[model samples]
Target: MELHFMGTGAGMPSKERNVTSICLNMNEERGTMWMFDCGEGTQHQILRTSLKLGRLEKLFITHLHGDHLYGLPGVLTSRSNHGAETHLDLYGPAGLRAFVETALRVSEAFLGYTYTIHEVEEGVVFEDEQVRVLATKLEHRIESFGYRIEEKEKPGRLCHEKLKALGIPPGPQYAQIKRGEDITLTDGSRLKSADFLEAPIPGRQVVILGDTRVLNKTIAFSKNADVLVHEATFGQEREALARKYYHATAAQAAHIASEAKAATLILTHISSRYQHGEEQTLLKEAKEQFENTHLARDFWYFSIPRKTASHS
Candidate 1:
């Protein structure tokens, strides 16, 4: 999976970063995109890119903070105007429905799409056999939440050469080989699929935490994440202030990534006080402890690689 950083500022919009929003590209088979957070002006950010409002299939909201949810009305309305014929579901904290209804009612904005709002609490917020999303309580002043998205493990790749050498034709045997089963031949010969399959490469995990200062909560969500998108609302020198505000600093975000054994750390929700060029400084600081730290910027898109061919 890959993440497209749509907004990466905190509290308010910045010239460099907007607010908290990111697009998650899951398996291509889904033909849809997932989103985390939708700060003010999120639709405007989408206007500057090729993102289709219709492609937004699922939304994982961290909290109901104005900076994180103010843009949701605009997003919903745009889908109606654009004539999107897909369903939209939102997962967030309690009172989410009230917030959405109040916003639409007060603004008198209309939408033409069917939508579902799930007011989530700390637990398995959403789950399918293929993917699962779990939420945890955070230390923010409000009842904030963090999410851990876990994709199901993929099957092992088939070693075609081994199967070919076993005198099995390349048709149904390939499926059995990848399934790690023994195919008994009509002649009473047994062929072990494991002998023709390599170890499976694990699917990617992503952890996105809300505005918080609790390292333990963030660490719990970020364990073994291929990408950890955490807030760095304060600079290292202002670590104390970060704690006071229930936010995180660049160093602290990196430390959480380190403890979680995340494959890469993407420091986002940056403070505008730090200039664009200074993002490199944040990257350097995180990389000191974690080698694969990268900064996410707006209008970026990523592609998730395909998993195994399934006829099992």
Candidate 2:
């Protein structure tokens, strides 16, 4: 899986960054993409990338803040205009449906495809055979939420070479062997499926948080995540300001990642006050606490490597 940052600025747009928007690229995994937020100018950012609007399957809004929203109507309209026929699912706090419907209504925008708006609560908001998404309340001025995405474990790789060596020809029976089914060969020889498979691969976990102040629950929610995306809206020197605005400083974000024992921490939602050249300072502050911290910029791509059974 890979994370594509469309915009990473906080509060408003700047020359160096836009606002808050992220796309979880799952094209290789599920042939679709899931967006985290659609801030203003988000579609413009997507135009610079190779991402297609039709590939967006789901959108998860963190809050109703203008920087976090304001682009929903345009994205939806554009998706329809582009001739996308697949259904889209939206998940967010209460009032999301009203906000979207009102905008579409006032603009006279007609969607060609159907959509579902799910008002998320503090729990598992979405789940399917491949993945599960959980939400938790976050400490922000408005009602915001953080999401935890857990991928289901994958089955082990079938040892095709071993089966071939055993004089077994490729056929539908290979699929049955991969499913752990023992079968009798035409010659009456028994074949054990488990003996021809490697260990099962472990699932991966990722945590993405909205704008918020550091909280204890957040640490627990992000525990052991392979990738933790948290907002670093201010430098460590602005701790008081961060708290006042219900935001987090780079140091504070790193603290949570350290406490959670996360494998990698990505700091985003940067304040425009810090000029382009000053990003290394914020990154340095986070690295002091957590060595594997990264400062995200617009259009940056962070690939989360899949964990193999041997690695797990």
Candidate 3:
């Protein structure tokens, strides 16, 4: 899996950054992509990457904030122009459906593919065979939400050596045994798969939060995340302003990462006040609390490696 950061700025666009948009590339696992927050110009950003609109199967909107959703209409329109014919699923808060419907109705934009909109609350909003997504309300000036994406555990490798040692011939029967099926040999002997297979490999977890202020629940919401993507809209010195604006500071974001024991913390949604070299200031502040923290910039993409035993 890979995470593509389209726009990393908070509130508005800047010369260095756009607004809030992210894409989770699941091509290797599912041959599809999932998007989070489609800020203005997000479709343009897609042009700079290898992302294809037709492969975007799901969109998770955190809130109705313009900075997080202004690009939806254009993106949807573009997807149709690109001949996207598969069904698309959208998950968001209550007003999201109304907002999207209004935009499409007013613009008269046509989508070649069918789509479904789901108004979500604080609970499991989506789940399939490979992954499950959970949503929870966040403390923002407006009603916002955070998402936790969990990849389901994968089956362990079959102990081929063990099976061979037991005089089991390798053939189609071995494939069935590897699927955890009980097998009866030609000699009327039973072989149990559990005795020869390793433990199932635990899957990775990713937590991405929307615009919000720091809260104690943040730690619980992000517990054990392999990658915890949090917003640091302000610097440590702007704690007062952060609270008044319903935002979080870099230090506070790192604190949550540390408390949650996240393997890596990615800070984004930077306020435009910090420009150019000034970004290091926020990075420094966050690193004081969480050592394995990185600052995200627009157009930056990260490949999420397999979770190590320590991270698991």
Candidate 4:
């Protein structure tokens, strides 16, 4: 899995970054892409990258703020024009189903594909053979939400050398053992699958926070995550303003990341006030609290390594 940032700016678009949008590349079988928060001009921002519109199967809305979701109508319409015929599923907080439906209806936009909108309350919103996605409510003015994506535990690999040593030829029997299935051998002896399989490796954990104030619930959801993507809408000096606006500052985001014990903290949802060459202070404030912190930018991608899917 890989996270590609289409827009990383907070309230408004700047020369360096567009508004909020993140694309998670999960591959063809599951879905080509999973989008998060489409801000204004998101389609235009996407034009600079090689993302495919038809494969965008899911759109997750964090909040109803214009800065975070203004681009949804445009992107859905653009995708229809760009040959996206597959059905899309949208998930968000209360009023989301009505909001998107009303937008499409009021505009009388003709979409080739149908959409099923779900009001996400909590628990797992999406899951498959490979991954499971859980949503936790965040502390924001609106009913915002944070996501915890946990890759499922996988099956252990087979030891082909051991099979050969046991005079087990490469056949269906060997395949069954590799799949952790005990099988009766030619000598009428049962072959234990564990003897030919390695130990199961744990999966990666990633947590993504939307526009919100730093809270302990959010911190708990991200405990020991491999990567935590949190919003940093202001520098440390603007803490009062950040609180007034129900947003987090750079230091607060890093502080949350540290408390969560996240391996790496990705600071996104940057303010437009920070000029093209003036993001150093934002970086500095965050780094002071958390060493493995990175400031997010447009088109940035993080590929989370895939583990073997559970066949149990």
Q: In terms of TM-score, which candidate is strongest?
A: 3
Instruction: Flag the better candidate by lDDT, 1 or 3.
Output: 3
User: Tens digit of lDDT per residue, candidate 1, span 1-312?
Assistant: 668888988888988889989888654746788889999999999889777778888988898898899888888898789888788999999989999889889989877778899999888988886788999888887888888888877767788877677677888867876776788887998888767767665666788888998467668678878778888887777888899989988778889989999877888888887885877777777778778777778776655454444444
lDDT of 2 by residue, 11-106 (tens): 999999999999999998999999998999998899999888989899999999999999889899989988999999999999999999999998
Using alpha carbons, what is the TM-score of model 1?
A: 0.87
- Candidate ordering by lDDT (highest first): 2, 3, 4, 1
Error of 3 at 129 (Å): 1.3
After superposition, which runs of candidate 1 have C-alpha atoms over 4 Å from their true positions?
A: 27-29, 105-110, 164-167, 170-173, 176-184, 188-192, 276-281, 301-312
Model-by-model lDDT, in order? 0.82, 0.94, 0.92, 0.86
* Prediction 4 global C-alpha lDDT: 0.86
Clashing pairs in 3: none
Candidates sorted by TM-score, descending order?
A: 3, 2, 4, 1
TM-score of each: 0.87, 0.95, 0.96, 0.93
| CA-only RMSD, every prediction | 3.5, 1.6, 1.7, 2.6
Clashing pairs in 2: none
Which should have the higher TM-score, number 1 or number 4? Answer: 4
Candidate 4: Cα lDDT at 140: 85
Give candidate 4 misplaced runs (Cα > 4 Å).
Answer: 28-31, 306-312
Error of 3 at 13 (Å): 0.2
Lowest summed lDDT window (length 10), candidate 3: 303-312
